[model samples]
Target chain A: MNLSLTLTINGEQREIVLDDPRVTLLDLLRERLHLTGAKKGCDRGQCGACTILVDGQRINSCLALAISYDGSAITTIEGLAENGALHPVQQAFIDHDGFQCGFCTPGQIMSAVGLIAEAQADGDAERIREAMSGNICRCGAYQGITEAVLDAQAKISTGKERDAA
Target chain B: MNRFEYVRPTSIAEAVAAAGEPGSAYLGAGTNLLDLMKGGVTQPSRLVDLTHLPDLGQIEQLPDGSTRIGALVKNAALAHDPAFAEAFPAVAEALLSGASAQLRNAATVGGNLMQRTRCAYFTDPASACNKRAPGSGCDAIGGENRAHAVLGWSDHCIAVHPSDFCVALTALGAIVEIEGPAGRREVAMTDFYLLPGDTPEKETVLDAGEMIVAVRLPAEAAAFAGNQRYLKGRERTSYAFALASAAAALKIENGLIVEARLALGGVATKPWRVQAAEAVLAGAAPGKEAFEKAAEVAFAEAKPSGDNAYKIALGKRVLARALMMAAAGTPERMPALPASPFAPLPEGVVNV
Candidate 1:
C-alpha cells in the first residue's frame, strides 16, 4: 500500500510518497532523501548504528516505520551542524579521537547529542557510558567515545550558560 | 518483509475497527515488530498505526493514588518520570535496564508487553521453531538451548518472554486495561501473557481486535515503593537480554516479613510469579535463611535443559540476592550479577 508522509528532516519539510509501507526511516533517509550520514549496521534495533533524533529524542531509525512518523521532525548527523559550524558533539569526537574507522561515528554523535538534550549523564563518565551503551563501536573506541561525550556535554552546558547570560 | 497496508487511526474505535480486520496488527513503536517483520518471522497483512490516537500517551495518577500508564507511553519517559519513578522504582529500573537508551525512547509500554521472544531459533526463520511455525518443531530444545526457559517449558517450546518491565509489573500486581470490539475489560498482568502450552503461537490472552489501552498499577504497590529491586543477569552490563532476572518487593515490619512479591524473568516462558516464594517469605524473619528458602521455592519446578542447567543455580542466587537487597532497603545499590555463563558464544552467534 502506498502512503504519503510529510516529515521535517533537518528542519526542512519534505513530502515522501512511499510505495511500500515496510520502508524504514533509515531507508527513507539514505535511499530517498540521500541523507547517508545515518548508517545501517545491523538493520535491526540491536545496534545503534541507525540512531537518529525524532522530535529531540534518540531512537533507532532502522526500526521506525517511515509512514508512522508523519509529522515528526527528524535530526540526523547531517542536521547536527548549524551555519557551517560543527555541533559540539561532532567537534568533541575529533578532539577526543572518538573514532577509529568512523563507521559508527554519525550514530555515536547523534546519540550523544540526543543524550545531552535530554540532560542525562550530567558530565559523569559512568553515566555517559551507560547512556551511550546502545551505540556500539566494534573498533574498541569506547574510551575515546566516552571522553568525547563527557567533553561535549561540558561544552554544551557552558554554551547554554553563556546563552542564558 | 511482506507488503502490508497501513492505516493511521486517530481514535480508539478506529484503531479497534482497523485491527479487527483479518491479519492486522497494531503498530506502536515498531521496535520489535519491525525487526520480526524484517526477519520474515511475522507477516501481518495490515498495520493499524495507533500513534495518532489522542490521550493515550499519558502517565497519570488515578484519584485513588494508583498509577495509570497509557499503552503508548514511551519506556524512557516512564522510567524517568518523577512520579512514576517514585511510585515504582523497581519498575522504572527494569525499564531502564532493558534495551538501549535509543530503543527505550522509541519503545512503548504496550509494545514492550507485546514484544516477541528473543530466541535465536525463533528469530531465524530457517530454523525449526514451533513458536514461529506450529508443528515445525523447536530446535532450541536441543540446539544451543542455553537461553531457553528452565521454569516453564512444554515439549513444544522453551522460549522466554524478554520484557524486563513486564517482570516488575508482574511482581507489582499490575492490571492491564484492554479495549476491543467486545468492549473494555481488564486482565491482571500475571494473566495477560500465556504459557507456551500446546499452542506456542498464541502468546497473549488478548482476543482478536483487543488493544491494550493502559496498565493500571494498584495503590497498594505504592506502599512498598521503596522496598523493591529488579536484578537482571545478562552477558553484558547493558544492551543484552537477561539470562535470569528477579523482581522482588518485600514489606517488612520490625524485621518480620509482612508481605512479599516475587517474579522471575528470562528463565521462564512468561513473566513468572512465584506465590510459593512469596508465601515462604511471608511471616518469616528477614534473613539469609528465609531468603534462601524463598529462592528455593521460586525454582522448585525448574526443569533445565543441557546447556542451561547453570540457570537453576544462577536464578536461585539472583532471587536470594534480590530478596536480601530488598530487605536491606538498598535496592539502588544492587549490583549487576557476574557475566552470564551463557556468554562468550562463538563468533557470529547471537544469544538466543
Candidate 2:
C-alpha cells in the first residue's frame, strides 16, 4: 500500500509519497528528497551515521519509519546552517579538526547540535564524550570531536543569553 | 525489509483491535522491531503504530506516591527526568548505560522491555536459532558460545535478554500495566519476562493483542531507592552489551542488612532474581564477606557452557561488587580492571 506523509523538514513543510511502508526516514531523505547529508553506514541502529533531530531530539533516522513521523519537525545536517553562515557546531568541527575522512562528520555535527539543543552537552568533557558516543568516527577523531562539541555548546549558550538580553 | 501495511491509530481501543489482527505487530519506537525487520528475522504483515495514542507518553506520579511511566515515554527522557531520577536513581542509570544517547532518545520503555536478544545466531537468518524459528536447533549451543547465558537457559536456547533497564526494574519490584481487547491487567516485573525453557519462542506472558500501557514503581520501593545500584561490566567502557551485570538494593538498619533485593543480567536468559541470595543477606552485616556469601548462593544453580564458564566466576564477582557498592552507598564508583584472563594478551605484555 502506498502511504503519503507530510513532514516539516528543516522548518519547511514537505509532502512525499512512499510506495513501500518499510521505507525509513533516512531512505526518504537520501533517496527521495535527495537530502543526502545523513549517511547510511550500517542501515541499522548500531551506527549513528544517520543521526537527525526529530522535534529537537537526537535519534537514528535509519531506524525511524517515515510514516511514524508524519507531522513532526525534522532537522537534518543540511538545515543547520542558515542565511549563508555556518552553524556554530559546523564551524567548531572545522576549527577543531573533528573529522578525518569526513564520512561521519554530518552525523556528528547533527548530534552535537541536538545535544546542545537538549541542554545535554554541558561544559564537562566527560559528559560531551558520553553524549557524542553515538556518532562514531572510524578515523579515531573522538578527541577532536569531543572538543568541538564543548566549544559549540559554549557558543550556543552564549548566543541564547545574548538573544534574551 | 518487507513491505508491510502501516496504520496509526488515534485511540488505544483501535490500536489494540488492530493489533489483534493476524500477523500484526505493535510499533513503539521501532528501534528493535525495525532492526529485526531489516535483518530479515521478522516479517509482519501489518504494523500498528502506537505513537499516535493520546496521553501515552506522559510520566506522572500516582496518588499512592508511586510513579507511572507511560509505555511511549522515551528512554532518554526517563533517564533525565528529575522526579524519576530522584525516586529511582538506579533505574535512571541503567537506562543510560544500555544504549547510546541517540537510540535512547527514540527507544521507549515498553519497547525496551520487549526487545529481543542480541544473539548473533538469532539475528542471522541462516543460523539455526530456535527462538527465531521453532524446531530449529540453537547454533549458540555448539558454536561460539562466549556470550551465551550462564543461568536459566534451556538446551533449546541459550540467548540472554539484552536489556539493562529490566534488570533494575526487577530489583525494584516494578509492575507492568497492560491494556488489551479483553481488559486491563497488571503483571509483576519479575513475572513479565519468561525463562527460555522448552518454549523459547514464547518470550513474555502477554497474549497476541495485549499491549503494555505503563510501568508502575511501588511506593514501598522508594525507601530503598537511595541504596540501589546497577553495575554493568562490558568488553569496553561504553556502547557495548553487558558481559555480566548486577542490580542490587539493600535496606540497611544499624549497620545490619534488614532486606535485600538482587537481580542479574547479561548472564541469564531473563532478569535473574535470586531470592536465596537475598535470604542470605537478611541479618548479616554489610561487608565483603557477607556479599561473597550471598553471591555464592546466587550462582549455586548456574550452568555454563564450555566457552562461557568464565562467566560463572565473573557473574559472582560482579554480583558481590554490586551488593557491596549498594550497601556502601557508592554506585558511581565502578572501578575499571585490566584485561580479562580469557582474552589474548598483547604481544609484549607479560602476565604475572
Candidate 3:
C-alpha cells in the first residue's frame, strides 16, 4: 500500500508519496530530498550521526520512517542557517571546535541545539548532558562539544528570541 | 527495509485493529522500530503510525488520581512533564539515564517500553537466538554473556529487556492500558512485563492485535511527600544500556521508613520487582543498614549466570543506594543517590 504525506520542511510545504517501506526519513533526506548533511554512520540507533529536528525536537532521522512522519514538520542542518547565518548552536560549535572528523557534526549540532532549547526552557547542565549524550562522536570530541553546547546556552538563555527566529 | 504497507490511524481502537496482523507493529516515535528495520533486526510487514492520532500523544490525569500517559508521548516530553516528574520521578530519571537528548526527542513512550533487547545474538542474524528465531538456540547463553541477564536467565536465553524507564514504572505501581480485539484491559505495570521464563520470545502480557493505549501511574500519600530515585550503573555517563540499575520509592517519616518500593533492571530478564525488600523496609529506619537488609531480601532469590556474578553485587549496590537517596529526600529537594562503584567509562562496555 502507498500513502502520500504533506509536511513542512525548511519552511516549504512538500508532499511525498511513500510505498516501499525500505526508505527511511534518512533515506529520503539523503537520496531524495538531497539534503545529505545528516550522515548515516552506524545505521543503528547506537550512533546519533543522523540527528534532525522533528517539530523542534532532535531525533535520529535514520530511526524515523518516511511514511510514519507524513505530516510532521522537519528541520535539518541545511535549515539551521537562515539568510546564510548559522544557528547559534552551530556557530558555537564552530567557535568551540566541537568536531574533528565532522562526520557526526550535524547530529551533534542538532542534539546540542535541542539541549540548548531545553535548557533555556529550564533544564540544567547535568540534564542537558544526559539529553545530549545520545549523539556519540568517536573522535572523542565530547569536552569541546559539551563546552560548545554550554557556551551556546549561555548566549541563547540571555539573548532575544529573534536570534532563534 | 523491505517493502510493506503503512497506515496512520487516528484512534487507539483503529490502531489496535490495524496492528493485529501477523507482521504488523504500531509506529510510535519510530526510534527503536526504524533502527531495527534498517539494521535488519525487525522486519514488520506493516506499520500503523500512531503519532497522527491526537489522543495517543496526550498525557492526561485520571479522576482516580492516576496519570494516563499516551503511547505516542515522546520520551523527552514524558520526562519533562511537571506532574509526571513529581508522581513518577524514577521514570524521568530513568529516561534521562538511558539515551542521549537526541534519541529521547525521537523515542516515544510505547516504543521505549517495547524496545528489543540489545543482545548481539538477537541482532546478528548469523548468530543463533531463540528469541529472534525460536528453536534456533541462543548463542548468548555461553558465547558473549557479559551484557546478558544474571537473574531470570535460563539455558535457552540470557538476553535482558532494555528499558530503563520501565523499572521505575514497575516500582511506582503503574498500569498498562491496552486496546485489543478482545477489548480494553489494564494490566498492572509490574505484571505487564514478564520474565523470559521458558519462552524467551514472549516479552509481555499483551497479545497480538493489541495496542498499548496508555500507561498510568497511580498516586499515593507521602511521608514528607513520597520520593523516588532511579540509580543506574552503565558503561559510561551516556548512551549505554544499564549494567545494573535500581528504581526505588521511599516514604520516610521522622527517620522511620513507612513504605518502600524497589525494582531492579539489567540484572533481570524483566523489570524485576522486589516485594520482599519492600516488606523488609516497611517499618525500618531509613538508613544504610535498612537498605542493606532490603537488598539482601531481593538478592536472596537471584541466580547469577556465569561471567555475570558481578551484576549480583552491582544490583545490590544500586538498590541500596537508590533506597538511601529516596529516603534522604527533604521537603524541598528529591535527594540524589551516590555514584555506583562500577565505572566502565573510558573503557568500552559495549561497542559505541
Which candidate leads in TM-score? 1
- In candidate 3 the C-alpha lDDT for residue B131 amounts to 88
Docking class of 1: medium
Measured by C-alpha RMSD in angstroms, how accurate is candidate 3? 4.4
| Per-residue lDDT of model 1, residues B158-277, tens digit only | 998899999999999999999999999999998998889899999999999999999999999988876787878888887889999999898888879899999999899999999999
Q: lDDT tens digits, residues A7-101, model 1?
A: 99999999889998888999999998899999999999877889999999999999999999999999999888889999889999999999999
Ranking by lDDT: 1, 2, 3
- Clash pairs detected, candidate 3: A131-B101, A134-B100, B20-B209
What's the true lDDT of residue A71 in model 1? 93
Better of 1 and 3 by lDDT: 1
lDDT value, residue B101 of candidate 2: 84
Best by lDDT: 1
- Model 1 segments more than 4 A misplaced: B330-352
TM-score of chain A for each candidate?
0.98, 0.97, 0.90
Report fnat in order of the candidates.
0.90, 0.79, 0.86
Candidate 2 per-residue lDDT over residues B87-115, each given as its tens digit: 78778878878888899999999999899
In model 2, chain B matches the true chain B with a TM-score of 0.93
Docking class of 2: medium
Q: Which candidate number maximizes DockQ?
A: 1
Q: Which parts of model 2 have CA positions greater than 4 angstroms off?
A: B330-352
